[model samples]
Target chain A: MNDKPLPETLLPLEVDGVSFRHRGQTLLDDVSLRLGHSGKTVIMGPNGAGKSLLMRLCHGLLSPSAGSIRWADGKAASDPDVRGRQAMVFQRPVLLRRSALSNIRYPLALRGMRRQQRTQRALDALRHFGLAELADRPARVLSGGEQQRLALARAWALQPRILFLDEPTSALDPAATKAVEDAVRAFHAKGTRIVMNTHDLGQARRLADDVLFLCRGRVLEHTPAGRFFDTPSTPEAAAFIRGELVW
Target chain B: MVDGNPFAKALELILGLDQVLVGIVTLSLQVSLTAVLTAALLGLPIGAAVALYRFPGRALVVTVLNALMGLPPVVAGLAVYLLLSRAGPLGSWGLLFTPTAMVIAQTMLVFPIIAALSRQVVEDLWEEYREQLQSLGASRLRAIPTLLWDARFSLLTGVLAGFGRASAEVGAVLIVGGNIDGVTRVMTTAIALETSKGNLPLALGLGIVLLFLVAMVNATAFLIGEGAKRRLG
Candidate 1:
């Protein structure tokens, strides 16, 4: 759906020796990974395994205390061009205290999209996500499912090259989870790269192209979805796949 | 002995629509409203800035603002009087003993209250909105309008509190306006004057009108807040 040519590609995200510390405690320790220009990569780990923290680091929400995260074209995350090409949806769906339409319109406005064009794009995104009727409703008051979908709609309006989902459906019911998963597939179908975190193995199996398994802030495995599930490389990964607590 | 009940007389004066009473009421509204509008215009941005930015002495500034919210009206009036007196720095403009001087005094008294309350509201909102706005590429400065607009309902209560302070205080307006007849005279000063002169009926009427106006302002704010909550929620 993105007819306009991109200014530059932002793929092949390279995380080099990235580490994060908080209050003298290291949360992510010497983590390094390379993401190429494709696939829905699911980050699976037990609680407190630094899955969300690592995603946030890659999305530029939080800076690493050590090493660097670089895009393929060398644009810094602080650059507006790079920021304009990425979006993140938090676990709780941080909707604005505004109408659903305005929530979608806000980022477009920040990107300097014209009023008429932004409104048109926002409406198309809402319609695409099947939220056309609730466009005028206050975003914060919407049901959990609707709010998450609206969050997706907002990200969709941005036409992000990469989308980060941090446990997006963890708080939703089964029906809502299904809707979010479908929306995630929709984003992937449009050629947007997806990086997500989930504790739900079934969800991981359904959506993951590759799985990155983590235990205690260390990456134990990064393999294709099938191989990672069928034959985990590390003891931690094996215990995790067997539904035993590893952390 | 007074001629009749003060309440009955107040109702009579109000129902009769006496010209002097109307003038006093009109002038009181003009001065206080002007003061509130001016204070809000200046204070809101200051409050938002203090909430969003972290500079040296920010904590001290916030503490000073909170302390200033309790500034005595007479002290504020005296401060303005000194600034506007013949020997004072701004005396060249000769605004002393005028309606504008009264407005300045009241605005001075009200600014701190608005600024402090708005700072608290905006700070709380910023905490909730920080991550989402940052992710959207909005700088702290760019997020101001959104934060302010979202905090509008709470800010309205702060403005009303400012209005209540301005309309109720006689010390500041009296010192600055000199209670001049048909000129700088307003409801609070006129009430004080008529009471001392044993013109109890007029004083009581002004008091009743002032109370009614304050009630109306509060009711309107409440209804607006409730309506928005229901509709938006």
Candidate 2:
């Protein structure tokens, strides 16, 4: 039901020479990549590859130690509208302790939407996510799958131009993972750009329009989904594709 | 020193609503409530600031607060006494030997209790909500009220704890209040005066009332906390 026309700004998400360091040790080296305005771009990397950190940097939740991240035609990511136009869901869904209804309403409230409109919007989101019956329940008491669905509903209700998800289904069972995959597909269908991180190669293959393979904080390969699986350019990515440790 | 059992006589005073007993109880509530309310007004912001922001000397501020939580009531009373004394810096206000001075002393006694406890509560809630709220576009300062509201049940316990401390304290109020008969005496001070004068029944009666008052406050806080936990969480 996303009839609302997309915003005019088509500034591709650009990460130019971004690096992050903590305690005098580099976590992400001079990594750079550009993300298109649509479809699922799954970030696949082994443990400690800085996948989540990079997603955070892209979402404007964290700043890089060096280099720049810009979105929407050179628009500063800190711009209120820019920030408002994107949302992120972490590995563990962070729902408010309020009712499921209120969890979605909170971000709408933050957007300063009027009570009547936001309430209806939130209710609609709950219905859309098959959570309408549980709307009155405390969000924290929901099942993991339900909580993840609620988190997605909360982000989707914001009508974000882009959604960043970090290992969204890492902790889910098969059925729950499938449910989450369906929701992610719905977001993609509605034309919301999806940039996600996952350790699940099969899930990545299923949902990814493209793959950004990272190894030890470096982008080993960023290629189309079909090509990445068939012929990864770097040995690190090839080894990772074969389920072997790169380092 | 009494001809009759003091406990029975004390119960009679309470049941009969003795004027002196009532006066002591009323004054005790007034002074302690004012003190706790003032302390909360000052403490909540200080507690929130310490929890939500990082700065130089933060560790020292927290250390002093933790230490102040256990500050002896007598020392606080003495400090307030000097401040309100004729030759003291605040002497011109003429607050010494007045109820105002006792309120000042109790506020000083419990401000740290409220601040320290609230800082802990708010800090824990902030830790849980920080990244989520920041991603939602709430700056650290903007998130304080939200975090405070969400942690309100815990913060209410801190206030109740402050009230308990202020109400039960005798040393601070006694020094600055002077326990003036029919003037500035509160429950704790009146009980002390009565005991010193060998009026065991009256003192014991006031002590009973003080204990009951504290129980009621703590029970009410507990019930509200449970209700909030059930309703909000």
Best by lDDT: 1
> Candidate 1 overall Cα lDDT vs. reference?
0.90
lDDT tens string, model 1, B126-192?
9988878888888899888888888888898999999999999999999989999999998899899
Task: List where candidate 1 sits over 4 angstroms from the true fold.
Answer: A1-3
- Residues A1-247, model 1: lDDT tens digits: 3448464478889888888899998888889898988899999999999999999888877899998888887766667767778999989877777899999999889888889998999999999999999999998789999999999999998889999999999999999999999999999998899999998999999999999998888887889999999998898899998999789
Model 2: CA > 4 A from native: A1-6, B1-6, B85-94
C-alpha lDDT values of all predictions: 0.90, 0.87
Error of 1 at A174 (Å): 1.2
- Count of steric clashes across candidates, in order: 0, 2
Query: What's the C-alpha lDDT at position A7 in model 2?
Result: 64
